[model samples]
Target: MALLHRAEIRPTKLELLSAWLPGRPWFQGEAAAGVERVAAYRFDDPAGQVGIETLLVRAGGGPVLQVPLTYRGAPLGDAEAWLVGTCEHTVLGRRWVYDACGDPVYAAALAGAVLAGAGQAEEYFEVDGHREHRPPSMVLTVDGAWRATAPGLGAIDRVEDGDPTRIVTDAVELAVVRHVGTEPGPAGARLSGTWDGQPAPLPLASAAPR
Candidate 1:
């Protein structure tokens, strides 16, 4: 389960994303005209140390881009180059945010979810000492020989940034769909999901031998 706070964040996630997205080599078009977060999904970190979230944002009527991110209590020293920006979380204090592709925790969680046919985590909003239930924004399923493994199975060996972000892990290779498309993906697709408003399920990532 994921618990969320209604507290305010200076330099909101969208604000930070707007400035950072345009600079990404894989990010096409402009975010300067503003962007809207169409939907989002979360995956749990088994160790409970990291926060994993994937945002679907649309800017200037362009394609809905997939932006996977990881939030941590401390800086990721080795992934400084992939840092999105630090933010002050109202309840969690200072947080270090980075692109999910560079975070081992996220890569592992995503691979695990795909192999296990898992969906977005259950969410709850923490209010004045009370918790309010919320529905997940995404629905995911899986197919193929990909099976769930012990924690930390998918250790990233390398990353390639293009229209699709390819992450090479010890167990498998993942092509994370950065730009939403209607076309189906290659064979051995271990992951498929539907965005909040999209009716047809689309392959979010395809898994294959590394």
Candidate 2:
């Protein structure tokens, strides 16, 4: 399947980001500030239905932090509740509006892409007050076919060990045990990690968004 480009997305995803950027916890702009797109790119999902976009914007003088997102319309409902705004396309006569990161579909798509060797390893040193500074500090090797290197304080190492996925990290003192689902969608996989020697299970849905 062909990768979805920013131009091909109805109404243009950049226009949507112009309105969405200020609402994120990681956004340093004023509460009602407006944003202008600096650069953007798209990732191709093997599953053609999901759309993934990586956007970089300039909101005054703040450093540029990458915002990766996925889009979908199947079972679409109440997307505007978390929506930043709408994108208007003069030629297409259509508008595409969506939430930047609160959707499960987008989150799952992003995780899937990272596991599929389609994500680039990078780090964000600065972040807004409310947001956590998650520098890329973990290394993930999936099934010996793909490797993801991350850097930072709380790093997570993810590896697929037969039926169960194992995550080991000394920085945060956690061991994650995951159960991969037989199917896709919201029920893709389940993950549980032991932090500080305590058992904590993170549902597949929760791990992606919040």
Candidate 3:
């Protein structure tokens, strides 16, 4: 279960993304008019050391763009380029946010989600000492091409940035689609997501053993 504390966050998520999204080479819309959060989902880190979140935001009414992010308490080594800037989480103090493509935890999580059938994490909100389960903003489903062995997600080898971010790990290659409405996904096991007002399932990612 993902526990969320009722704390104020400075430079709000949207504010931070607005400044960072436009610079991305794969980004297609203008962030000047402002970005709007369309939906979001998350996966849990088995070790509970990092937070993995995928945000689907729209800029200037353009197609929803997919941005996977990881939240950590400290900077990731040699990942300054993927850094999305830091934010102060009133209760959690300072947080270093980085693009998920460069974060091994996220790559592993995505690999499991796409190849092992693992889905989004369940979330719970805490306030005034009371905790309640919170439904996910978006729902995801995956094609479980169950294999005899689990993915060897030990280390990420390389990452290629573009419309669909490519992540190559020790045992699997996962591609994360950047645009929501892109048709026909990658080959092999894949995962799809759906949100309110969405007519059909949108392919989020695909994975194949390396």
Candidate 4:
């Protein structure tokens, strides 16, 4: 489960993404007009430390781009190259946000979800000592059953930021789909999602043992 606070953030998620999206290798075209939300989902950190969220957005009417992000209270050591920038959180103070592709915590979580066929986290809003349920913007499902498998999910062994960013762990490799409606992907377990405009299931990420 994931907890949320009713707070405002400076340099909103979209605002920061607008300036960062165009520079990415996976970005198809210039985002002069910025990006708009297509769908979003979250995964929980077992230690309850980092905030893990993935956003799917469209720029200049182009393909939907999947961007996984991890938010922390302090800077991640030697990860300046992966930093997406920082923002002020009303409740949590300042946050250091990074591209999840480079964050080890996200690497472990992503592999765990794909191999185990886990779904997105449930959300709850916290306010004035009360908790309220909040429906997610979209829903995600896996292609197979929950098969227990342990992949070497320690440090990131490699990362290639192609159209489909390939992330490698010690024992697994995951192809995170950058463009929603692209190729079917390599043969393996996959994560698919559907939202308002997107009624049919769409591939979001694919995983295979390495």
Candidate 5:
């Protein structure tokens, strides 16, 4: 379960992404404009140390892009290139945000979700001390291969930039489709999802061994 606090964040998520998205080599859009948050999904960290989220946003009526992000209390070393930017959280103080492709926690979470068939974390909000459950903005599915567990998600060995952000770990390789499509593709294992208002399942990712 994911508990969300009603707190303010300086330079809201869209503001940060607007400035960061265009600069990415894989972003084919000419310029990011009218960026809107279509839907988002979350993954829980077993240790409860990091905040994992994947945002599906559209800019200027262009293609929907998948932006996976991780929030941490401190900066991640050797990830300066992947840094989206930093923001101040009303409840959590300063936060370091990065593109999830390079974050070990994100990789591990994806691995666990794909191999173990784990769904997105359920979200809840606290209002006047009462907790209310809310449906997740996005729903995801995983299939193929009965090996529902990786030995252990190893350190990130490499990351390749492309339509699908490919992450290689010692145990497996996961591809997060930067530009999601309605049509499904071949894969040893697959992860697909539907946005809040969209009924058709969109392919989100695929996984295989290195």
Candidate 6:
């Protein structure tokens, strides 16, 4: 598998973020403002084609924002509909950009990285607040179930929990602590876990922003 070191990435991940962050709904930056990279790291995939990155960006006044993204070749076909942002890769010298969340392959790689301890939760926060921080714990189940719990949010709110009918992706991780389970409904197959050793609260949005 082709594993890229942080130093090995072209155009630098931060450079990519400078152009990418502004477009995100969670981004709290002035239009056209530049973003600086505070720290960065990557998780390796057994297959070299897909890549996962965890990046910290300093966009002026707000607390550092952690953006976890995946990259791949081509348009991801039908998945392009949910793309966060795409641009020509001056680094790889490619013309297309892709969002991993929309790509099953990238999503699975992210989950695997979490399982491999390639990420930390200290830097994670709600996209809107940009200040509230989530802890660094993730829950993985053999039955294809998962969930996420931000600071103050209580036990695993099922994101997806059911039979392991398909192996759409290999893994998933929250930069912060999240719960995993196999249930249904609003809390179905969700993220749930503790923050700073305390039980997470519910409605992750209710907790005060860090």
TM-score for each predicted model, relative to the true structure: 0.91, 0.44, 0.95, 0.95, 0.93, 0.47
Q: Which lDDT value does model 4 have at 35?
A: 88
Task: Give me the candidate number with maximum lDDT.
Answer: 3
The lDDT per prediction is 0.77, 0.38, 0.85, 0.85, 0.83, 0.40
State the weakest 10-residue window (summed lDDT) of model 1: 182-191
RMSD list, candidates in order: 2.1, 15.2, 1.5, 1.5, 1.9, 12.9
Better of 1 and 2 by TM-score: 1
Q: List the residue pairs that clash in candidate 3.
A: none
Q: Alpha-carbon error at 58 in model 4, in Å?
A: 1.2
lDDT per residue (tens digit) for residues 62-87 in model 4: 88889999999999998888899999
Over 1-210, each residue of candidate 2 has an lDDT whose tens digit, in order, gives 232222444445655665656555545644344555544444454455655554555566664444545555442465555554444444333444444344444443434443333443233222333333333222222221122532221333332222122223333111112121121122222221122222332222111211
For residue 56, model 5's alpha carbon misses the true position, in angstroms, by 0.1
Ranking by lDDT: 3, 4, 5, 1, 6, 2
lDDT tens string, model 5, 1-210? 777889999978888998999888767554736578889999998889899999998888678899999999999988998899999999888999999989998998887787677778888888889989988778888877446454476777888877788888787888888887833233667888987677988889877765
User: Which residue runs of candidate 3 sit more than 4 Å off their true CA positions?
Assistant: 148-150, 183-185
Model 2 spans with C-alpha error above 4 angstroms: 1-15, 30-33, 71-75, 90-95, 119-210
Candidate 5, residue 114: the lDDT equals 75
- The residue pairs found clashing in candidate 4 are none
What is the per-residue lDDT of model 3 for residues 141-174, given as tens digits with 9 covering 90 to 100?
8775676434778678888998788887787888
Per-residue error for 178 in candidate 4, Å, reads 0.5
Taking the tens digit of each residue's C-alpha lDDT, what string does model 6 give over 100-150?
Answer: 444455444444433332232233333444455443343222222332431
- Could you tell me how far off, in angstroms, the CA of residue 163 lies in candidate 2 after the best superposition? 32
